[model samples]
Target: MTAGVDTGGRAPGRPRSAHVDEAIIEAVLGLLAEGGSVETLSIEAIAARAGVGKATIYRRWSGKEALLVDAIASLKGPPPEPLGESVREDLIRLLSVGPKKPDERTAQIMSCLVPEVQRSPERYRLYQGLVEPRREVMRQVLRQGISSGELRADLDVEVAVAALTAPVLIQRMLRWHPGLDDESLPARVVDTLLAGLAH
Candidate 1:
């Protein structure tokens, strides 16, 4: 081979950057915070808020629904797999994994989602993909409690999850009352639920 000869001649592949991913996601949240509805949140607006080109977003996401799903999903870090050891401990860890107390700004962002979905229900079914994983995490912890004899074996997983989380959601997402977004709320919810289910 000649010295300085071209090596593999093809241009290096430029994989997408995480920073760009984060910016786009943040832009979605920002637009939601600013009262932008789902139907109105264009790729152009998101690209502008994120300070990236429209092509960059389209390369990563096919449309606004996908982008919204991803952005909402990014609001929190991934939940830890629920270890069977001490359900209380596991619950605490899971609750603490993400943003603990979503404040008014956070609540405002979430509050806008319902009306947005109502605007174009079919286009936003993608949102369901983001919710199932979180539900599964809670269910895992509940199943562990059942197997460990810490909770009633007959407990309904779906109902239990809704009960366990409803208080926080109601206070923070549904209504904006002061002092409702307490960091200790989940720990308290777990305790109250377990107390009722203890055999």
Candidate 2:
């Protein structure tokens, strides 16, 4: 029941059903959860899993890559909308809103996709398309901090964003630490970066 894929524009046929869309996406995730990769995934299998025809999926997406991209994007939902009230608070909010629980299925899906995306340039670009907009949200917050003189005037926004976000993402995606559920971790990360970046 995450967001559905954007069909871009209307096609000259029956309108797309949100129910069918969710079924297709869930089918993709279900397969990935069972250890399927992009290489191993096929439209035929997805159609069967979703209880739809191959033409149904084709009507929604061009191929497996496009369908997979939309499915993964749905998993992420949407990025947090940053409040303009305070830079530190906004950054913390963005960093804190991710899978805090031990979701083996999500972790497994990521593990399956990360390497495969890295190896394929097309997949890498599609993945970047999904990630960069979220990163840009953080960049905009950093720029606002600079404008308000809340952060160092010479602060490199990209580096500041990376420093602030990397640790949290590493923990959430890779589970490198024992504190995935640590609610205070976001504030600590923001404060630590601010100590160096704050004006």
Candidate 3:
């Protein structure tokens, strides 16, 4: 739910470039894509990749774990308010969320992070901080639809939400199906499910 993080709290020094923050995050993600294991990744690697001094990174983050958290969290944008009163309209909006730019790096970061997050509590905590709130909103929207009789009275909101999200995650993120990653995909998925679930 929180977006637009506080920009203050930097180490006492000359002001840092807003671009430096981005470059450090880009470095972390880039290293992650190259399979930067704990044994291999270090402050030196990130600083070198980001084209900055170690102090520049340290100025913003206390250490690697803190830096990684900030990097992953930045990939997730602020959750948008549900756009429509109807369940179908809202589902379409929620499911189409992604970067405005055409880049594979964001997906690549997620592809790498999904499994790694499980073993690292630090990573899991940081990943969940961005994911859990958005899921809760989807659940709320489904429940409201059910109560209003827009959806099946017997519809399980939990199952519905999973049904709503799983295809996009699986095909887009897990399986890497090229055909399924189009802009129309969200609408198509929602329509298919709503036809069966809507009363």
Give candidate 3 regions above 4 Å deviation: 1-9, 12-16, 101-103, 176-181, 197-199
Candidate 2 versus truth, CA RMSD in Å, comes to 2.9
In candidate 1, the residue pairs with backbone N, CA or C atoms under 3 Å apart (3 or more residues apart, or in different chains) clash, namely: none
Tell how far residue 166 is off in model 3, in angstroms: 1.4
The best candidate by lDDT is: 2
Stretches of candidate 1 off by over 4 Å are: 1-12, 175-181, 197-199
List the candidate 2 regions with Cα displacement exceeding 4 Å.
Answer: 1-10, 98-102, 179-182, 197-199
| Candidate 1: RMSD to truth | 8.0
Error of 2 at 145 (Å): 0.6
| Reference-based TM-score of each model | 0.82, 0.88, 0.80
Worst 10 residues of 3 by lDDT: 1-10
Which candidate model has the greater TM-score, 1 or 3?
Answer: 1
- Please give the RMSD to the true structure for each candidate, in Å: 8.0, 2.9, 3.4
Q: Pick the candidate with the highest TM-score.
A: 2
Q: After best superposition, candidate 3 residue 94: deviation in angstroms?
A: 0.8
What TM-score would you give candidate 2 relative to the actual structure? 0.88
